[model samples]
Target: MPETGDAAPDFTVPLANGDVDSFTLSERLEDEAPVVLAFFPGAFTGVCTDEMCTFQDRLAAFNDLDATVYGVSRDSPFALNEFRNQNGLEFGLLSDYNKDVIADYDIEMDFADLGVYGVAKRSVFVVNGDVEVTYAWVSDDPGVEPDYDEVEAAVEDAA
Candidate 1:
């Protein structure tokens, strides 16, 4: 997993909001803005819904801090778009359908009890304009969520 001060792995993935579009981490880095990558196991699940909704609720604060937030999951763009629309989320959701990003971030995990394999562990990474990690949080349990206040503080510092 990437630690603080380490370079965040760059990725180009399909971003789903109201419509599908391409998103590139490296390209966003050029804008010199703080980026928050929130990874969840799946979309439409209870915990995932709450986590994402929480981010949506806190979006204004993050925006005030000049930070961009993205929720990531191993779901198809169509499914993600539905999830975003249903949740009324303003931020984009990245479709890691191939699970490549999870592997790159070393956050791949399996939900043995659910018979699910190769899903992204719940994780949050704060990357500064320089593409370096300013904060990192990962949960072994899918039910866990990141500390919103801490993430806000991290983005504030990065900004």
Candidate 2:
């Protein structure tokens, strides 16, 4: 897993924001804005929905701090688009359908009972314009959520 002060691993993948587009982490870094990557297990689930909605509600505040937020999931781009539309999310979601990003980030989780494997472990990472991780949070329990205030503070400090 990437720790604070470590360089973030970059990846290019499909972004779902009601419309599909290419999203490149390194490219976003080039904009000199702090990037918040929230890795969720799946879409349309109770916890995932609530977590994403919370981020949506906090979108303006993050924007004011010059931070860009992205939700990362193993769902396909089409499903992610539907999830964004249904939740009225303002930020884009990256599709890690191939499961490569989750593996690269070392947050992969397995739900053996559900027969679901290699899903994200519900993580939040803050990477600054320098491509270094400013904050890192990972949860083994999918039921847990990140502390929004702490994440916001990390972005503020990164800025």
Whole-model lDDT values for every prediction: 0.94, 0.95
lDDT of 2 by residue, 16-51 (tens): 988899999999888847999999999999999999
Report lDDT (Cα) of residue 132, candidate 2.
Answer: 96
lDDT of 2 at 6: 97
Runs of candidate 1 with Cα error greater than 4 angstroms are none
Question: Please, what are the lDDT tens digits per residue for candidate 1 over residues 1-159?
Answer: 999999999999999978999999989877747999999999999999999999999999999988999999999999999999999999999999999999999999998888999999999999988899999999998888999999999999999
Poorest 10 consecutive residues of model 1 by lDDT? 24-33
Cα-based TM-score, every candidate: 0.97, 0.98
Candidate 2 wrong stretches, greater than 4 Å: none
